[model samples]
Target chain A: MIAKEKFRVCPDTGFKVFDTTEKLIKINAVVAVVFLAVGGLFGLLVALTRWPAVHLLPADLFYLVLTAHGADVLLFWIVFFEVAVLYFAGSVLLNVRLAAPRWAWAAFILMLVGAVMANVAVLQGESSVMFTSYVPMRVAPHFYLGLILFAVGALVAMFVFFGTLVIAKEEKTYEGSVPLVTFGAIVAAIIAVYTIASGAIILIPTLLWSLDLVADIDSVMYKLVWWGMGHSSQQINMATQVSIWYCIAAMVLGAKPLSEKVSRGAFLLYIVFLQLASAHHLLVEPGISSEWKVFNTSYALYLAVLGSMIHGMSIPGAVECAQRRRGFNEGMFGWLRKAPWGNPAFSGMALSVVLFGILGGITGVVLGAEQLNIIMHNTLYVPGHFHGTVVAGTTLAFMAITYLVVPLIFRREIIWPKVAQWQPYLFGLGVTGISLFMMGAGTLGVSRRHWDMAFTDAPLNFDVPPAAFLMMGLNGISAVIASIGGIMFILVIVGTILFGKKRGEDACRTNPVILPGGGATVMAAGSEGTLKLPGTIALVSVFFAAFVLYYFVNWKYLSEVWPLS
Target chain B: MTEHLNSGDGKSGDSNGGPENGEQRIHAMQSLLDNPFLLLFIGVAVPTVLYTVWGVMEVVQVPIGQ
Candidate 1:
């Protein structure tokens, strides 16, 4: 007979947490935070170097730091946290014991080794090629080997998640379907499989080329395949963040999806069309055909945008529905107004949804358009768009969820509750400023990869408008602020985990959080049982209006650039 | 209502309420999500529309002389 498992039944949500899953979640989360600290430091250096006034590093060092920043923040930190999230969704939410605990540990070790190898390669100054690593500009063999090892490790972790889901099903953990959060995670894992496969297909050959075993690695072919992994990795973030959005809404405010059917449809949409967004990276490439280009950019892409727009609406709609049910139903936005604004979990997610939808989602659709891609394709605007999506949208959402993780999983009280409340806002404001200023600078034709905004040492000196310099200076200040916010988050989470008092069962009973206050009750019988979504409708309309206006504005801008003759 | 979910009184009762009742409710919800027609609609309809849009854009972008 299979051994009976021990479960720590949470007093708050009644979740049966397996000891192994809990341990794995804590290890992965702690490591993710450590990488975030390293990446954030590198981010500061890159930002300062980009600022004309400060100009912190020389060109070569600037490139090295930039490479490290991208690899750590974008790949290492995010993926590590995502592995934790995958385990949480499969084992914790599904109320099942984790499968293959030994294998999971092996996966974590491989990931750690790979991440260290990659970072060491970059810092040793041989692998200064940026995150894209477009070749014939080759790095050392270890650089590619590091990435391959990390990918393999991450892929193994995903298999563990899948195995856990199978265990949940066979063990009859839940009566109906798995929880929606688990379902969303399934989408992320599925996409991750595709992404890792894509990465291996290209990276292995490129590694051979790097080692001089292969004759040549074509640049055009590399970009086409590399983007399949590169851009699709962000799609994984999108799915995971949206999943967290739902979790935060439910845990913090006691919300449910407005319609589970429609919400799942959106996730289904992501699985089908979201990867097409990778085409935006190849829009300017000459080797690609127009038929392929147009199909990916406009036709295939708009459908994917529709999927995101669905989520962009449904997430907040669910939140509003929950808030209104709690008797915050005075006006159209009273649900929003009366929300637990002081709770970092709720506020962080709320800001993530808003800023991402406005800054990231709109700019992404615009950038993907065939004609408008010309205007901002390789400019500072590219990074601006990502910061909005990846940082503002995904990273902030992850940060919001960590507040819940500390209390719910770790069973520790937040060390500084008051400071935690301000962390999201400070970080949100700084990132927003970063996205806007970078986009503004790009609109004035600021080069993206250059260390010097002034281009002082170039053979041919180019004069950009003075506004670009001002934008870079402003971006530097914003980066500093964002870094402080990052530090605050790390301190709050680490301090809480290490030093905060252990909570008794009674504390868990009264307040679902290990944090200071109680969460709003999540009742199945919400006011949302009857459809009352006028507030959400109005909000969604505003988003639609902004999208249309910005899209048209980009088209107009494209028209003004070297008239279509 | 708030008190019910907040204290988790409702959740505990629902789980212990009866396996049959819980399974029936879940079955009803899962059927809609699992329907082949709905799955096809979700997976295929958007890409088909996108393809049509691609065709139109290609026609629009055809050079004036050619």
Candidate 2:
């Protein structure tokens, strides 16, 4: 097979690039962007409708747009990119030919068909059950079928990832452990396997019920099993994005993990504890044991938080250490201040780390508390929290990596480099505003799924505070800004891929500012490999202080909600 | 300069840069698999044990009928 196969070593990065893997990665990434465009458009409509002033869509259209938005952005776009990431991490990183290239194509087609089918079903106005599609709502059969096909296809692609790993091992691609990026990807794939299996367990039955083949479905049972797939999919994102963080840090700064064993231990903790977050959704629901809820939400889930905390510390610690080694050591913050912020890759990733750790991580800990969930569980705050994690964290990280992928993988110079430099900041600011304002409105008790925040059309009108209305209006404005930023991203990625000038091999053959020797290896700076990380320690202290303050604030709010004293 | 190294450690660099011989490739992979941390069982086994014990204790400690 080795003698028979023909592949090229990327001159810029020195990774073995298989023709099929290249085709697969390119196609998946392009399609993922297409979904992002569609989803972002739907999201703008959703924002306008939620604004009391705008109220853009009627109730029916609002739910439909919301459904499409969730499906496209959360499920379709992210997973398609993830499939590409799996292939990149597996075949390219391991320097092995992809196993079962033909099957990989089949998986891609199935996913594309499923995604389009689900979207079409939503547009038809019969499947506007939102992404959860909770039981007894009774969506069209094709809606469930579309999701099932998509899950199965994704599962097949995951298997292809596994097969590629085995092929790499059998072919002796690398030594010691797999690279940490590949290691994190493996964690994602493992979690994805369980998630998709959970989907099959619940969804297959629900599909039967939808078709009237089965009589009835239990709502609680459905939610329990559904979240195993639903929320865990986000867990997959968490792990994958963390992996990309490591990759970006290494690529841009030639950084290494603070400690391989500790980092690996954190990843292992994710494998054990991350999916327990699904229980957060079920905390306030009845009939589930308090013991189960308490354990899942508090003790075990905190371990998962610990995993995230480790990555948060180590990723920046690695960067600071590497930067200092390169003589950027004027002050505690000089290394960070002197970082390559002009590079969209570095800026996007850096913002993603800060926003995710501060906004997502803190809010997540608050929500995961069994008692504290009562006030905010069904409010707009839930989506606000996720926006912090998914959009600000994962999507931004993915967008950051796309900057590198365009040049390295597609062999094109980035078009409009100046615009690319500012794109992440604009996007980050808008998304941050959206998250904050929505959470503020939710604190005043804005319903998550209600189309009109004003209750203008409700049978019995209720007064939502003036501040809530103001926050909704601000959310509308923020959405417009974010939409512009998103458009800029799509334009840059699409324009560059299609029309950007071909990068000469000589120009890419060496990356002197980052990697040495034309990207011959993932250069990890700092020969000593010690954790003299005062900067990271200070940062972590600040994070903990914020976390503690927010935790107590939420508890105080919870107490005020009950006036039982 | 004789052989290019991939993303692993120094000593285990492929002798000829490419996968020239089956035995050499197998040897490299075996060394990776033999490492305690890399093996899947060693990686996840302890966490699984800890979670199980923690779960049981929480279940026992929960006040019944609350």
Candidate 3:
């Protein structure tokens, strides 16, 4: 062999500086926060309108706000933040620079322009198609155009992520296989591309219809394709949320998954399976073939859920291992006691996992079932279930990640650490209260999107008792409480960004903090500080198994028969 | 020009080094291009593009039913 000279390696891994990924994350976080505020305002309006006593706004205004809330919060805020997270994971975690910074900027601008145009059009009363923007409920051409532009921008961002992944592999920046978090994000990006493509398929025609280029469009087909966008986008949110859960756990607790291979394998399965799982949304819709519906709602949905479940179990497994390493002698649940409860990232993530499992997961699985869906479809329970998943699960995870990123990227201390500590609890409690109330009313046959339950002038078919209406009013109050928590969160975030103390000497330190784990034998001290492999793998694997189990059940039950027929 | 070149190398990697090390770096970059994940991304992306085009074509062909 030719004599090879050894190159001196940089100690810090040079991952932080060259990556402009952190800046991208900060920008996305700010935008997402604004969108969350806007979305919350709309949600408040809708809640008040639904409250029998309040009836705060007129029917028309109610619909507008309801539509805006869904579009802005569910679609816009989540997707934009997801793109930013994708950029962060693909570059920072993988130790690669962005493929094209200029292109990334272009994508952001396009998305912003689209969001602005869509909002303006909605406010002007030009498009009242609701968040689905279904055909036959025509909106202005600009509305569709804005949506197209945003989707295109997101598509470009995905391309850039893939490009960066290519560069990272070429650079040999990562020693082993890609990290679990980055792998999960890559899967999310892949699904996002498909979801956006589906959006373009439906929206372009709707735009044409608005321009009078086409006479009309099929409502049923439009719904089908739109769900391809709608439902699939939500799956992207799930994947991204799961990825963040892993990252937050790792960062805050210094926890690692027990089995890297299993966790990574679960992520790969998500990419292959989640996109096709959009059929669950159409199970209750008429005109869709029974075979397609069954295959979609049961089989595909189960697969997606299985992916989530695996991650759910895996995260806690890592936490347990980390706790044991920190010299906690508690038995099966002893690690939990020793774990850092004060850390915002750890608490937020732990709470999110619990809420998602008990509330979100249960409601999601039940709703995906054909027979159960018929009862819950278009009820207050529908929004209740989704809020548990998307808002409580995904949005809360994002907030937890933000707590970490704010310090790392913005170089600021957290303002109002005390108030920030209570945010997740108050907000989560309020959401749980509201969702439970809605679920109760829904069980008694309460409907959604109705202006007035008291107005008997129209023929009312369902016999909903007066108590249900009263309970809905109570739900509205819970929403108000949640909104207060949300406002406090925003203030804390803004304060941190503007005036938090910047870390000075501590910025140069790179010692890996050791977390509590299950045993000392499994924890080895090395140059990297402490290695807790089994715990990390266990944490990641539990969620992987849970997600797989959900999908398996869904496939077995829902995919075999078309519930609609 | 010299300053700009120096900065790029300093940020990225050491450009002026032993010929053998430089050659190894070049080989690494080439190997990265042949990564399976990169090829997988491209492979999936092409079909996705094609499907998008096909879906768009269907939209263009069918007239809106009044």
Identify the leading candidate in terms of DockQ.
Answer: 2
Ranking by DockQ: 2, 1, 3
Residue A208, model 3, lDDT: 86
Whichever of 1 and 2 has more TM-score, that candidate is 2
Worst 10 residues of 1 chain B by lDDT: B1-10
- For each candidate, what TM-score against the reference? 0.89, 0.90, 0.81
Local distance difference test values of all predictions, in order = 0.81, 0.83, 0.69
The candidate 2 chain A region of ten consecutive residues with least summed lDDT is: A518-527
lDDT of 3 by residue, A493-527 (tens): 88889888774434435321212221111111111
Q: Per-prediction count of colliding residue pairs?
A: 0, 0, 56
Clashing pairs in 2: none
lDDT comparison, 2 vs 3, better candidate: 2
Off by over 4 Å in 3: A1-15, A453-455, A507-565, B1-66
- Of 1 and 2, the candidate ahead on DockQ is 2
Ranking by lDDT: 2, 1, 3
Off by over 4 Å in 1: A509-531, B1-66
Can you write out model 1's per-residue Cα lDDT over A1-565, one digit (the tens) per residue? Answer: 7687787987766777888999999999999999999999999999999888899998899999999999999999999999999999889887789999889999999999999999999999999999888998889889999999999999899889988877887887754455667778887877777677778888999999998899987676677668778988898899899989887887777776666656766787787787767778878876456777777778877877887887877777877877776788987889888988889999999999999999999999988887899999899999999999999999899999999888888888888999899999999999998999999999899998888776787899989899999999999999999998999999999999999878668876565552222222221322233356888889899889989999999888988987766
Error of 2 at A140 (Å): 1.0
i-RMS, each model, one decimal: 9.4, 7.9, 12.4
Badly placed stretches (over 4 Å) of model 2 are A1-3, A457-462, A509-514, A517-528, B1-66
Give the candidate number with the greatest lDDT. 2
Task: Give the winner by DockQ: 1 or 3.
Answer: 1
